[model samples]
Target: MRCAHCHEDNDLGLKPPPPKLQGVMRKGKMPSRAVATDQSVAQTVLAGKGKMPSFAGRFTEEQMRALIAYLRTDMPLPQQ
Candidate 1:
């Protein structure tokens, strides 16, 4: 399933609830570790881990950078 599927409303009742990503960028407390660097987080998104599936080719380089940048911000990305 997609990230929004679990993160959006976040009432799916799945075991091991998916993380709420609203402030993950500012928090730097991803399930993996503290002080998550942009490059390392990008690697996790691209490679996936455990239950999360890989998205290796789903995004262009530009798009990937944009995603990372969005996650790095303290504010929520403005609505599309």
Candidate 2:
């Protein structure tokens, strides 16, 4: 599989790390942490958030869906 952001060839079996935490917190409020779930990753790729570039025009929705499905099967989540 290729990196959605860089287009560099990445092993489909390799699991990507979660996105870094962002946003400010009020007093006694917990920090906002965003995970790298399959859905989030697809949205990020489609919307191009942060360091991720959008794949909206580059790939068709069906292609994106296939990629997501492949990733889900090839890259299992790490043990907590």
Candidate 3:
């Protein structure tokens, strides 16, 4: 959630709030018009969605794993 586009507070009125990850993961809805999975979330991060920027080459697989794991735990993103 370090990315400005992913963090709602940082984005402000720039675009729609990035969907709530916990609910999206649990319910399979939001960011996209369909249900979400770890793989899909990773894809969204890598490819970008809506106003969110793409992180395609910015993170390693391990980093993506860490990010998904963190979201599944429903923990708040740490402050920079």
Candidate 4:
């Protein structure tokens, strides 16, 4: 797995930190939720918000979809 933003190849066993959103949770911080499918994730990636920058210009629609698919299965769950 690699970082979608940085493109650094992360070891398969290593887990990445969760994305935090201020004011979205009662505690003032929230972890990003999954989008259910690769396509949905790609759309969200293209239409970024908050701390997530849009990938519209950086990657094509097909590349975004591939990235999302990598995130869905290869990336580890957030730490507890």
Q: TM-score for all predictions? A: 0.73, 0.46, 0.74, 0.45
What is candidate 1's lDDT per residue for 7-48, written digit by digit as tens?
A: 554456767876666677777677666456777778888998
Model 4 local distance difference test score: 0.46
Please write out the lDDT profile of model 3 over residues 12-62, one tens digit for every residue: 665555655554555666456755778888888898877778888999999
Error of 4 at 77 (Å): 11
> Model 2 — TM-score against the truth?
0.46
TM-score: which candidate is best?
3
Clashing pairs in 4: none
Error of 2 at 44 (Å): 0.5
Stretches of candidate 1 above 4 Å error?
A: 10-13, 76-80
lDDT scores in order: 0.70, 0.47, 0.69, 0.46
Q: Give the local distance difference test score of model 3.
A: 0.69
Q: Can you tell me which runs of candidate 4 are displaced by over 4 Å? A: 1-31, 76-80
For model 1 the TM-score comes to: 0.73
Estimate, for each residue in 1-80, the C-alpha lDDT of model 2 and write its tens digit.
Answer: 33532333332333464332221111212122445565665666687765455667877778878766655454432222
Error of 1 at 69 (Å): 1.2
Tell how far residue 14 is off in model 3, in angstroms. Answer: 1.8
